[model samples]
Target chain A: MKIRIFVTLKNGVLDPQGKAIHHALESLDFKGVNDVRAGKLIELDVDDGTSDSDIEKMCEKLLANTVIENFEIERPTDQAAREA
Target chain B: MKIRIFVTLKNGVLDPQGKAIHHALESLDFKGVNDVRAGKLIELDVDDGTSDSDIEKMCEKLLANTVIENFEIERPTDQAAREA
Candidate 1:
């Protein structure tokens, strides 16, 4: 199964990369950008039988640093139908 | 309005970061992992009136390197209803 994991910094955590992007956008003359945050989108191709807990373990063990990062897992079965 | 932009390497492009992640998973004894790809997720807080073309411009000009990467833009209006 295909799984997607989004790892984002928790609120109140400092994000220097995000701040840099925000500055770059301003220099490019793109207006009205209130804020910018950067995160990770990891795509994994795992076996269909991989259990939920196993995926969670992956996140907790390696994919995310629990202290300042939050992860959200999207299983193939949970994905909403996309519009082509 | 909130907008999400996902930037991923084009097919056939090398991803060293992804390879490192895959190797780490194996060392940790996680199995059934077929492939892994790493990408960037950028979240922006922009004006509600920002036009689609403007967002596209942002991606083309700064967010993504069109030669080796592809970017997908998701507007708040395009999001599917979530279960919460």
Candidate 2:
């Protein structure tokens, strides 16, 4: 199975990288961009039998720093098609 | 309006960061982890009137490296609720 994890900074956390990107956009004259926040996407190819709890444990242990980040897991329906 | 952009490395590209993450998971004894690929998620808060073409141009110019990365744009449906 293929699982996708999105790890994003919690609201109110300072994101310098995002700020840098925002500045870059402004320099390029892309108006209307109010703010930017950056995050991470981790794609994992794992055994089909891997339990949801185990996956959650993975996130808690290393995939995310829960103190400043929140993570969402997605099991894409297209994984079956891809495996087939 | 809020938009999300997912940027992922193209297939066959070497991802050292992902490799390191995979190794870390193995060290932590997370079984069934076959492969890991890492990417970026960029969130943009923009004016409601921003055109889709302008957003696409932003991605092409700064958000993604078209030579080795692919980007997907998403306009979340819950933006209304959040703004409310």
Candidate 3:
């Protein structure tokens, strides 16, 4: 089975890369753009029996640096409904 | 309102960086780890009434380079309900 973890900075954290991209977008004449925050997405193909807690542990231990970011998990079954 | 865009390589795309990370994990003595795919996550704070269509336009035009990756969008409302 596959599990996806999305790691993002908490709201108050500063994201320099995100800011640079935001500035570049404005310079390119794209209006209506507001603020930008950047983070990482990590996809894993695990054994089918991987537990939810194991996935969480993976995020905490490897997929994310929780000191600066938060993570969300998504399963393929949930993603399928969203595909529509 | 907030819109989050996740950008990931489509299947069949080679992700050397992800492979490197996977190998690193194994070297670190973490067993049972299979493969890794790395991607980007972008978060945007927008006007309270931004439409789904506009958020999608942002993904296609700015948040992702569709030539190499695909993107998915998540609205705060949807996210909240999922939190439960």
Candidate 4:
């Protein structure tokens, strides 16, 4: 099975990169775009029996830097429908 | 108040950028590193009482390009505790 981890900056913290992109978007005439934030994704291919706790551990230990970021995990079938 | 959104690619898809970074990590002697995926994060500064559904709408409507990606929303208080 495969597990996907998404990591992102926590709220209330300033995101310099997001601000830069927001500015760039505005300069490019993309209006109504208020702000931006940035994050990372990690994909893990594992045996079919990886537990949810294990996946969470991966997010906690490696996939994300918890001090300023948050992460979420999704299974393939669940993610495919949720995003769309 | 603020809302933070995280967008990530779905599993089973190839992440060329992540692969490149993985190779770089290996070259740098970071062992046990397997694969990486890339994604985006968005931070929105809004009224203190923005509804959960409204934030969900933002993710569904624009912040996340759902076709190949998935997104999650976390309130400041929740995210701060969850990630840590």
Candidate 5:
């Protein structure tokens, strides 16, 4: 299975990277961008039988820093097609 | 409007970060893992009128390194409900 994990900063956390991107966009003359938040996308190719709890455990153990970040896991349906 | 940009390393690229994560997972005793790839997620809160072409330009010029990275843009429908 191909699993995708998105780890984003908590709402109140300061994101310097996002601010840098926003500033760079302005410097490039791009307008109307109100806010920007940067996060991580980790794609894992695991065995088909990998359980959801195991994946969540992976996240809790290593993939995410639960203190200031939140993560969401997605199992894309297209993975089956890709593997076929 | 809210737009999500997923930036990932292209195939054949050497991702030390992903390798490190995979190694760490192994260290944590997680099994059945095949591969891991790390990427970036950038969330943009832009004006409702921001054009898709404009967003694409942002990716091409600054958000992604076209030579080694691929980026996908998604406009989540839930943004409407979130803004409500």
Candidate 6:
């Protein structure tokens, strides 16, 4: 099975990389871009038996820094349905 | 309005960061982790009038590297319903 994990900075956290991108956008003449925040997307291919809770445990143990980041998991099959 | 851009490496492209993460997970004893790939998620706050085509233009100009990356855009309100 394929799983996707999105790790994003928590509210109020300072994101220097995001700031840099925002600046880059402004310099590129892209107007009306009020703010920008950047995060990580980690895709994993695991055994079919991998349960949802196991994935959550993986996030808590290593995938995310809970102190300053939050994570959301998605299955590609489910995501495709939503996209359609 | 809020927009999300997911940038991922194209297939066949080498991803050292992803390799490192996979190694880390193995060392941590997380079984069934077959493969891992890492990418970026960029969130933007823009004016409500910002058109979808304009956002696509942003991706082409600076948000994503067309040479080895692909980007997908999503609006928060639309995503919320899908999640529910």
The numbered model that scores best in DockQ is 6
lDDT of 3 by residue, A58-77 (tens): 77877778898899899877
Candidate with best TM-score: 6
lDDT at residue A44 of model 3 (Cα atoms): 85
Model 6 spans with C-alpha error above 4 angstroms: none
- DockQ, computed on Cα atoms, for candidate 2: 0.50
For candidate 5, the per-residue lDDT at A73 reads 83
Alpha-carbon TM-score of each model against the true structure: 0.94, 0.90, 0.83, 0.55, 0.92, 0.94
Q: lDDT tens digits, residues B10-58, model 5? A: 9999999999999999999999999999999999999999999999999
Each candidate's interface RMSD (Å, one decimal) is 1.5, 5.3, 2.2, 6.1, 5.0, 1.3
Output the TM-score of candidate 1: 0.94
Every model's Cα RMSD, please?
Answer: 1.5, 4.2, 2.4, 6.8, 3.9, 1.3
- Candidate lDDT values, in order: 0.90, 0.90, 0.80, 0.66, 0.91, 0.92
iRMS, model 1 (angstroms): 1.5
How well does candidate 2 score on lDDT at residue A74? 72
Query: How much is A6 displaced in model 3, in angstroms?
Result: 1.0
- Candidate 4's C-alpha runs over 4 A off are B1-35, B39-84
Residue lDDT tens for model 2, B1-84? 889888999999999999999999999999999999999999999999998899999999999999999998877553333223
In model 5, how large is the Cα lDDT of residue A76? Answer: 59
Clashes found in each candidate (C-alpha, N, C closer than 3 A): 0, 0, 0, 1, 0, 0
Candidate 4, residues B1-84, lDDT tens digits: the string is 666676777777677877875675556554454566666656676566667876676667556778888887866775555444
Residues A8-58 of candidate 2: C-alpha lDDT, one tens digit per residue: 999999999999999999999999999999999999999999998999999
Task: Write the candidate numbers in order of decreasing DockQ.
Answer: 6, 1, 3, 5, 2, 4
Worst 10 residues of 5 chain A by lDDT: A75-84
lDDT of 2 at B61: 91
Q: DockQ, per-model, please?
A: 0.74, 0.50, 0.54, 0.21, 0.54, 0.76
lDDT of 4 at B17: 76
